[model samples]
Target: KLVVNPEKIKSLKDVKGKKIATPQLGNTQDVAFLNWISEQGWKVDAESGKGDVSVVRTDNKITPDAYKSGSIDGAWVPEPTASKLVSEGAKVLLDEADLWPDKKFVITNVIVRQDFLKEHPEAVEAVLRASVRTNRWIEDNPEKAKAAANAQLKTDTGKALPSDVLDPAWQSIQVTDDPLAATLDTEADHAVEAGLLEKPDLTGIYDLTPLNKVLKAEGEPEVDDAGLGVE
Candidate 1:
């Protein structure tokens, strides 16, 4: 989501000349934001992150503090962090998902070392099965899943998200097994437009057989790899 300080921005046009943040220079969100800015007829130096707008590459964990300190006026950030900024008086001016068809985009995906996968196909299948089952569980019991997720976060990170930040962030997410591969391809194009990447072959970038097998066994529709899967 693109969140802004309500006091500073009244609308998207107001974002011009404002200081905005992304997780890292040349990262996914940064590329997307740069592409959007270019489409708006704005010019920016992608590497230095300077021009019509200031693209501060701040880590998500400290984004809320950056916002509070007025180091940034807004951020193109992922959840919990987005909600945290909202808690600090930021307004969600745009949901990036809405920019894509059907309001769907890739937030995360599983990746494994090719050698490890080849040596342990069974283990790969098991991980995919677990992921599929967890997505289904989240769909079936959202509240319970949220609680479990918070508990796990606390266990792993030593702190849990507060309900005020957790609830809305959880509600905004759509857990799925598909991976939305086409969106990844599109994001690569965004990177190219942002001058962060060159056009290159992405053929055979995915090995979705394990994922499809897990889905088939679970009686769920299989997913495609946007023609980038191993033939």
Candidate 2:
């Protein structure tokens, strides 16, 4: 579907002056869309320095409802919720996975307090260790992955998620605790390439030593990069 969803969304020009629903202004998706609107040469506000696309501020869960009631044109929603909305009657005008060909998207990520990492270094190691195994498990077991995901999200949604939503999300993701630096080396590259940042000077962003030490102790097999997302 990455190949199917073109980066140049057709008829977004039709949306000039129309409300573009998003989770939050200046959050990643908002930034991406604003950049795109600028690229399209539409009128942007001088004072706010934002795009011509009217930003419809809403929570992620409420966005589909906003769309249904004709309050917003479309939303920057995460899967399986995004695709679920389409199934329930809202149209999927732009699926980002389909929009950016040969590129992948990052969905959920784990964030820990800096103090937590500093104080409980061993705990961090355990988490990464469990994550390594979990990552491997997800790669090896798609059915279980879907079941776990559906259980986590679908019960909240009150319906079975179409596999189309879960399949792509699962395939495009990995579960791991690779040192943030190693992960961000690739992430920074993608982020910069996407014009999200000028450059990511990863000075205080991550530390890899604790995780490396854990891997050493575990005699962990070097995981292949093929299935796991983004190196």
Clashing pairs in 2: 5-98
Give residue 37's error in model 2 in angstroms: 1.9
Task: Give the local distance difference test score of model 2.
Answer: 0.56
Query: What would the TM-scores of all predictions be?
Result: 0.97, 0.67
lDDT by residue for model 1 (168-190), tens: 99989899898888889999988
Kindly report which residue stretches of model 2 are placed more than 4 angstroms away from their true locations once superposed. Answer: 1-10, 43-51, 89-102, 105-107, 154-202, 214-231
Off by over 4 Å in 1: none
Please, what are the lDDT tens digits per residue for candidate 2 over residues 5-55? 122233545656666665664555655555456657775552243456666
Worst 10 residues of 1 by lDDT: 199-208
Would you list the C-alpha lDDT of every candidate in the order shown? 0.92, 0.56
Scored against the true structure, residue 148 in model 1 reaches a CA lDDT of 96
**Worst lDDT 10-window in candidate 2:** 1-10
Report residue 166 deviation for candidate 1 (angstroms).
Answer: 0.6
Residue pairs with clashing backbones, model 1: none
